[model samples]
Target: MTGGGAAGLVGLVLVSHSAAVAGSVAELARDLAGAGRLAPVEPAGGTRDGGLGTSAELIAAAAGRANRGAGVAILADLGSAVLTVRALLAEEDALPPLARLVDAPLLEGAVAATLAASTGADLDAVTAAAEEARHYRTS
Candidate 1:
């Protein structure tokens, strides 16, 4: 989806209250992932009206696009964003079975997940990588 041979790689979705934040984070994660092939990374932030809020519909749509058959990993900025993603997943049973909601630091988790996905990691691995990012400390 993202890299030329990334069709089988797991996808990632960054959720935030601000569209700009999501886009910026996605870019940073992509850069951190380096040249290896990576699955699609979609940003689902803000409401359709461009306000600061999360939308279940937008998240669901982004998940659909990111999940290029493999699976999707979601990283959220706040409680509301996480709640929105959870509601969408619960309501939409058609979403890919591999799709998973990860509780991790937004930027760190995105970077870790992107890197893992670029390496063609499976959904569980990618999610685990993201969750592990929470313990990453920069000294």
Candidate 2:
């Protein structure tokens, strides 16, 4: 529910060890991109017990929610979050079709990927946008 209800736009899944952190990041990215300027974004963070850790089930569910028929781009925080995503990717039929794990800064990368997806870019383009954010200069 982050976009203008635009159909076919690529979606985003934000993964983090802390549920609060993931949710807040998604909110911030949505606000930064502005309403109707992004596709569906889902946050899958922490464990079912509200503990600080990664959950594969949560990640899969988020990816499913984020999907809009176009594709899904996943951004994970460092450490086991990334490892969880990688493990999910390795399994057959683990993730939704066209869903991919993006290696980039959690905050900046999500914003970039969300902006790119808002333009109806494909999965590859959105992933590329997030990956490209790794080189963004903060100076």
What clash pairs does model 1 have? none
CA shift of 134, model 2, Å: 1.5
Where does the lowest 10-residue lDDT sum fall in candidate 1?
1-10
lDDT of 1 by residue, 1-139 (tens): 2334667889999999999999999999998787657568899999999999998877888888898777899999999998887877786574566778899999999999998888888888889999998887842
lDDT of 1 at 76: 95
C-alpha lDDT of residue 82 in model 2: 91
TM-score, predicted candidate 1 vs. hidden true structure: 0.91
Q: Residue 39 lDDT in model 1?
A: 65
Count clashing pairs, candidate 1: 0
Global lDDT of each candidate: 0.85, 0.88
